[model samples]
Target chain A: MKQKRHETPLEAIDRMTDNSVVFVGGFGRAGVPERLVEAVCRRKLRGLTIVSNNAGSNVAGIASLLQEGCVGKIICSFPLAREAVAFRDLYDRNLVDLEVVPQGTLAERIRAGGAGLGGVLTPTGVGTDIAEGKPLIEIDGRAFLIERALRADFALIKAYKVDPLGNLIYRKAARNFNPIMAMAADWVIVEAAEEVGIGALDPEHIITPGVYVDAYCAVTRIDQMMEATP
Target chain B: MTANCGLSLDQMAWRVAQELQDSWVVNIGIGMPLLVPPHVRADRDVIFHSENGIIGMGPEIEGGDHVDPDLLSAGKRPVRLMPGGSFVHHADSFALARGGRLDAAILGAFQVAQNGDLANWKLPGARTGSIGGAMDIAVGARRVLILMSHTTREGEPKLVDRLAYPPTARGVVTKVFTELGVFAITEDGFVLEEIAPGVCADQVRAGSGAQVKTDGATLMVPPDPVSPREPVLSRA
Candidate 1:
């Protein structure tokens, strides 16, 4: 196995290119890969597609990318919030494309991608606008819409702890989209708060194993990273 | 606003809390439904599920320097977890809902059609709106209950004969709890189950855009309201 460790976020983000499909993990303000996203912003990549739960807040994270014109389209569950003005303005002006998937559907699509499934058949968003353009198959007379699997060229994730081997563990609910996204991306770059010894992280307790990780950056203080201005 | 004419914000939350049965896993929506957890009965083993992955959610952390950014509700507010609380990844968390493991989902709504159609995600004429988890929770949960004001901010009735706004889900709402009364959506239409104290059936009918059947209406006795007790700051 090659050494999957980077000394800095910029070194980890060097492989990214224009028009790449990216998965940015986080649920709201928590578990955001701040330094990695900052590096993406500085790289000034264009026509990128961002897949996440919600669009980033107005001031930082994905919001900075939208302001910098780095994104061409955003595929997310919820893109509207008081702090999500950056994406909302771009959406209203028709400058960016928006694909709104239900939260469950979004998660399942990514899961299917990682597991190499063709698609997911779910009852969510049935009898509504979400079912309008999709094929509805009835299994045992129960309606389910077909949602295609979503994969990405790169994934930016945050973890609470990591070992030398790239195994990861996340804290509390911050573990939202990181684990699944790690599996679905061609190159998974993680920013962890702490780096423990090789034998420190228990094998059974690891949420993400070393095999899925391609590169990683370790931060001393997650708070300072979160509080940084974009 | 007059004496006991309708339920206050706290009273509405208290009433919704009473509907939660023991051992039932419930997903509470963001706004008014967030208040329900504070009023839940002590004896009931209700598990509060946040779509963000918390299985046994507790109330908001009162005060301390120990606020963990990772320990947050789906609403993005700081919160605590119960003794048995556990977390999962996003996919597994939503699997609990989409797989029909959640007992009930109580949410706030913009409008509800007489046939139990929900329209909460988008408003009329809005270019874009957030769907969040409403669509998935509405269709997946065993029972979907709505908690909101009887009318809009302009005093327009929200219970309408047909929805002008886009529907979140069709024929999914099982019950609606508003300030004016409790309503059950049935085969016939909107049935007035219980009227709020100091409010009459005629008032409910007049306030509703859809026809309200009040033949079996009864007076409601809501639980007493109790605000969450936080630590009081003392000045030296």
Candidate 2:
């Protein structure tokens, strides 16, 4: 079995290149890969596209990337949080590109990318601005908008526990977007709270099976600002 | 509109909460809709769905020592999970809404047109706004209930004949609960289903941008507004 575990998060995230499309998993700070995001910020790579639920808030997480002028485009569902001044400033100044997708469609599109599907036809965005300029198809007397699959060069994700083989589980609502992102990216780097022994995690309870994970690091700072504080 | 003329915000939330049926899986949207779940009757067994992957979610966790930062609502407020609660990832969680598993979705709105068209995501000519999960919940839920004030703070009616703002979905809203009363989106138009105690049909009509039919509408006399911990039953 391959040893997926790495000595540190910075080393685990060593393969990310400049101008890469990255998937940062989280929903309003839950399940966010803070340490990996910090590592990417530390690397100061430029012109990256970030796909996530929220465009990072003003202070932490993906905001650090935007603060460093590293992002070129952002594809997300909501970018208008009160503290998301970082994204708003750059977007208003035309310094970055923005594509707002319906939250469900974003998830389905990523899932389609990982599952080897062509695209998704969803009713979530029909009759709205989201439907504008997108291909519309009528099926069974209902309209559905065509959303293309979204793939990334790398995915930064957080997990609760991982085994030597990289099998993973998440705590509470922190599982948002992490598992699917793990499959959608070419390389999946995980920052987990604990690294357990193989076969220690119950097979029935594991959320992301080890085969999808490329590299993993066990984080010592367990409670280090995982949530975007209000 | 006068300050004392309409139901309080909590009263409006209680009115909306009363409409939920037993065993219904309901998705509560952010903002004012967040106020509805807390008022839900404990006996109703209404499973609350948060877009960020919590099912059977409980109330917001007040500041405490043991608050797990990972456990949060879609609104990002720390919350607790009920005994039968379970968690799924983002895709599977939204599948519950888009796949028609939700019995109802209670949401906050900017405008609800007479024909049940909903405009909530963004304002007209705004540079940026958040769509979030409002669109999915609007089109996929079996029923959509809206909670908002009868009029904006500027006193402009939110229940309109046509939407000036961008719509989240068309012909999706089943009912709307506001400070003035409960308005059911019927085939005819907005029908005044329940009027607040101090408000009259003329006032409701004046407060609505669309025509409001008050025929056979009943008066809603709620009991004293209390903390959400206790059920605020209405007079039968």
Q: Score the docking of each candidate (DockQ).
A: 0.54, 0.59
Q: What's the TM-score of candidate 2 when only chain A is evaluated?
A: 0.95
- Over all chains combined, what TM-score does candidate 2 have? 0.96
Candidate 1 lDDT by residue in tens digits, B1-236: 22236888888878788899988999976888887876777667788899999998877665466567778888888787777789999899889987899999999999999999999998888776889888988988999989988988777889999998888998999999988888999999899988888898888988899998998888888756646433222112
- Strongest candidate by DockQ: 2
lDDT per residue as tens, model 2, B45-114? 7888999998887777676765678888888888878767889999998999989999999998889999
> For candidate 1, what's the RMSD?
4.1
Error of 1 at A221 (Å): 1.3
lDDT of 1 by residue, A1-230 (tens): 68888999999889999999999999987888988999999999999999988888977889999999999999998899788989888988999999999998999999999999998999888888889889999999989999999999999999988887899999888899999999999999999998888999988999999999999989878453242110
lDDT of 2 by residue, A3-31 (tens): 67899878999999999999999887878
Clashing pairs in 2: none
Off by over 4 Å in 2: A224-230, B1-3, B230-236
How does each model score on TM-score?
0.94, 0.96
